[model samples]
Target: MLEIENLHVTVDGKEILKGLSLKLNVGEVHAIMGPNGSGKSTLSYALAGRDGYEVTQGTMRFDGEDLRAMAPEARAAMGVFLAFQYPVEIPGVVTMNFLRTALNAQARARGEKEIDAAQFLKAARAAAKTLNISEEMLRRALNVGFSGGEKKRLEALQMAILKPRLAILDETDSGLDIDALKLVADGVNALRSPERAMLVITHYQRLLDYIVPDHVHILADGRIVKSGGAGLARELEAKGYDAVIRSAA
Candidate 1:
């Protein structure tokens, strides 16, 4: 559902992703494991069409549509969802209202009827419950004073309600405890469908255990150095990225 070819991204005059190419097909979950400064998050931002992530070269297409030409909101409306590693706190905006507005906005953008308030509230409540989000938390300002786990769970809740075709999770496992991690992973796994694709970017292999990916890729210095089946992640866990990167080199 997503295609990126020879993508070179520059952030603040520094080239991050150099000649990176990846294609995620429908009904697949791909894990990208890389060390720090390897441009893993850069890839996610570029795909989400975030400003300042200039695509200096190559092309990014989402389901045959040019992503580079689309704005961030347009990309989100086109079924692209990004779960940030550090979710920002939007003070004064109630979480439930924000979610409902976002969902309905996407629906309207797609030329579909907006969801009724009653229907939206029911769906949102169910999703929040599945993610272990409390009613009080939903009534609070978006991500305001939330624990890291709570913020991540809210991200998953948004994903569940929106049902994006391509979900880019940028370190969704970060700052999660064992229990919180399991809850978040379960939420993600529940969204897996024949028409959905997920790109999971993480540093540790522990996250992979919960969300088993169809393929594992080793990204280093802004490009994918190796691609393999699920075993590749275990191998990286065993030998470390240094050894695997050296061997791949």
Candidate 2:
């Protein structure tokens, strides 16, 4: 569903992603395992068309459409979702309201009818329950004063409600305890569908143990150095990033 070719990205005039290429098909979950500065997050931001992460060279296409030409909101309306590594706190916006607004905005942008309050409430409550989010949490301002686990769970809840065609999870496992990680991973795994694809960017194989990506890639030096099946993640776990990249080299 997504194809990138020799993508070179520059952030603030410094090149971070150099000649990177990847392809993800529908119904596949791909895991990108890389050390710090490997351009994992850069890939996600570039795919999502985040401002300031300029694509200096190469092309990114989603479902045969030129992704670079679309704005972030347009991309969201086109079913691209990026779950941030650090979810920001939005004070004074109730979590439920924020989800409803975002969902309806995407619907409107896609020329679909808006979801009424009762329908949205039912969907949100069901998703929140699956993610173990409490009713009180939904009533509170989005991510305000929440713990790391709470913030991550909220991100998962957003993903569940958004139901993007392509989900790019940028280090969603960071700062999450084992229990919290399991909850978040379960929520992610539940959304896996034949019509959906997920790009899971993470530092550790622990997340992969739960998500179980169809393909595992080792990204290093702003490029993907090695790509393999799920076993590659376990190998990386045993040998470490330096050793794995060295072996790939």
Candidate 3:
């Protein structure tokens, strides 16, 4: 579970998120819909404790702990995962190697012993298969020369393997074709459980068709202006964000 209270964030001295607040409970799925420059991505980065994005005024709590005081790695170790919109390409970093390192790092932080190579391989292989990613793909450099869809699938692979308690997907549906989108959505759906929560950030309702959220939120000008049920998503898609914004206004 996670809670944000009056989250006001700034980047390069420009305010982006102003008095934004939301609460998510375990096993619940929420979708954040907004127009461009609505500070959706900023909220994700700020919640993830990414550097450079200053949290001028606000408090973010993850499972009752103050997330603002913790480092990014600490947040990740505490079961917070952020699926980035643009997955960076890291040449010379084999996908498997990077994954193992990340998994081991989190495990160690939690005082858990690192998994053996054989066990890691078995789990990774199974997860990759579920995501329709081949071992050959995992053997290559991380995100290097991979298609947009491929990168998104790789993100899902990581998510499945990590099994974070709270996952924040920042526009994972962007730039994905129908097939790729479905694959990613399936992966997300497969990971949904009573112990986890998800915040899906997207502009279109098409992705919601696959991952139907329990709640829908409309964010505009750095604040959540509207909150509704699944029907709100359909209404927004049918009429566009202008209607929602005007109605909220």
- Model 2: lDDT equals 0.95
* Model 3 TM-score, all chains together: 0.99
lDDT of each: 0.95, 0.95, 0.95
Segments in model 2 whose C-alpha atoms lie over 4 Å from true places: none
Taking the tens digit of each residue's C-alpha lDDT, what string does model 1 give over 1-249? 788999999999999999999999999999999999999999999999888999999999999999999999999999999999999999999998999899989999999999999998888888888888999999999999999999999999999999999999999999999999999999999999999999999999999999999999999999999999999999999999999999999
For model 1, the local distance difference test gives 0.95
TM-score per candidate, chains pooled: 0.99, 0.98, 0.99
**Runs with alpha carbons beyond 4 Å of true place in candidate 1:** none
Residue pairs in candidate 1 whose N, alpha carbon or C atoms collide under 3 angstroms: none
Model 3: per-residue Cα lDDT over 1-249, one tens digit each: 799999999999999999999999999999999999999999999989888889999889998999999999999999999999999999999999999999999999999999999999999999999888999999999999999999999999999988899999999999999999999999999999999999999999999999999999999999999999999999999989998899999
**Candidate 2 versus the native: TM-score?**
0.98
lDDT of 2 at 192: 98
Q: Model 1 residue 108 lDDT?
A: 94
